[model samples]
Target: MQAPTRTARTAGVLFLLTFVSAITGAALYAPLLTDPDYIIGPGADTRILLGAVCELVLIITNIGTAVVLFPVLRHHSETAAVGYFAARIVECTFIAVGILSILAVVTLRQTAGPDAAEYLPVARALVAVHGWTFLLGPGFVVGIGNGLLLAFLMYRSHLVPRPMALLGLIGGPLMSMSGVAVLFGAYGQSSIPSALATLPEIIWEASLGIYLTVVGFRRPRDAETTGTGAQESRAPRS
Candidate 1:
């Protein structure tokens, strides 16, 4: 009913949408991601195109979350809020590039026809670009933005439970370190260790989304007390 409540609900929905869109998009792209010679083979053009659509949804929801939350977050700390917003923009930018790369692959597949073999290297290169963007965008930038900055704000502002926020505090750095390790070839991106490392962050975000959607933001203790005091002061004289 109120503005803050509406804002929280909108942001929460956006967060959940981001999760859905991202996962669905990645799954839909499996044909390309798993197959190196997909460009030359009978490509799942329609499926791949659908995947690109999901990713476009992801980009929208990703930026929407930041935009919806910025006003509330800035009330707590303007600089951190701005940083988080910027981070979301950067993350979405990477996602957009990745989407374009995949689209290019699809285009080549459709138009290249029998000569697809010649563009095999080019298609693979494009896939590689998408892979790197995934790592850098969702892998690294998400750690800094959603994991650290957003979590810290939620923790400090008492917008959500501290324990929930704590998950982000811990997970953010772990996710970033894991990204770095993957970057340095400590393990493959799809390895068990990488999945394990990503678990906490996944939980943090999922829980935050659920909580904000269901319970909405909690008013700070001081704000509650101040409101009560103001009400008492305005009471009629005995």
Candidate 2:
């Protein structure tokens, strides 16, 4: 029997980061939307301040995790080498957007203080870009990109069990399309169609998190699932 590898472990950890960041990010938006009383008019209140801080953290951590995880997927995938790299490119976009988002809030403070409401339009654009690119964009990409790539490689190469491969296959497109919905700003409104569209995306991400953590943390059963992450070595032997 072959030993467990590092690939498994690395993917596992990446998976953990991916979902934890996602859930946190998604959860944060809820309070802001639900309770506008705290946000609409804010003094230097601790809770209000902390909420924004949490949002910034959520953006940073989520985007950061995405930036890191794509490479892990690329390193592991056998097909769609370009696609895997595209995933990285997409993630970098997310990071750029995340940074801009941080700057937007900081700038908001500066602007809101004086007669800088003129900058409101600029701030809105920046926040919109950040929202679409970093939070929603990468959120959509990571799940489908990695998940599909994993399934393809495992199925085509016979790396892992077929059931796992199937999950990747089914989940991948579902996730990718959901991500694309974000590109169109389907989540921008509170309408039923918009909510319905956004629901798939949230579910897609949540499912990805559950799948990766469950699969990643499991004890290695074969050389296919060894100690650290035997990415290529997991290919079946003749």
Candidate 3:
């Protein structure tokens, strides 16, 4: 078999970066963020520091996906490619804002001391900022950028299997809709329904990363034919 092309290798790295960042960031933030006492509790400093690190990774890799894929994707559709890249940038910006909010909470916790209760309101507000950023960045922004544009391009180009691409096609809109529902107070963000709504997208991303890493995309027809011809030429003849 032929070695993977530079484009394929780059795609693999980008996908893996997104996969790692998503999982690690969420893991670091979810439990602590969910706890009401997190801001006032012991180890709050360490937890917030970890959250900051994770968000930073997410911000960088989120934009990296668009940057790495643009060269190849643009060849297929320049308009869509640029749109995806821009959307990713927006997503990353919101994530960075969220990180700042988390840091603010940490700073307050450090200085408030015995008067932490007095500053609780401000901490909650900062947490709310992070929550809104999460909703907008991974929830809505991903729907437009990673979900719609990325999947559509892959589907159109036959870069990966159509069924795999369909996951993003279907999941993206659902996630975005769910995000809107949360914004409107349709359901709690941490509720079971919310989890179910987001599951497809989670699977879509995980599958995308694995597929790109292991399968490394489907080669164009002409390239496959050329590879086969070259192999046959190198075979021993009678």
Model 1 score (lDDT): 0.89
Top of the candidates by TM-score: 1
lDDT of 2 at 56: 53
Clashes of each: 0, 11, 0
Single out the weakest 10-residue window by summed lDDT for candidate 1: 222-231
- Which one wins by lDDT: 2 or 3? 3
**Considering every candidate listed, which one attains the maximal lDDT?**
1
lDDT of 2 by residue, 122-183 (tens): 55565556556644555566555555654565444343455556666766666566556655
How much is the lDDT of residue 123 in candidate 1? 93
Alpha carbon lDDT of residue 228, candidate 3? 32
Q: Comparing candidate 1 with candidate 3, which one achieves the higher lDDT? A: 1
Question: Please, what are the lDDT tens digits per residue for candidate 1 over residues 1-238?
Answer: 1238889889899999999999999999999989999988888989999999999999989989998998889988999999999999999999999999999999988899788899999999999999999999999899989999999998877778788999999998899889999999999889999999988999999999998899888765433464533443566767
What are the per-model C-alpha RMSD values against the true structure?
4.2, 6.3, 5.5
True lDDT of residue 168, candidate 3: 88
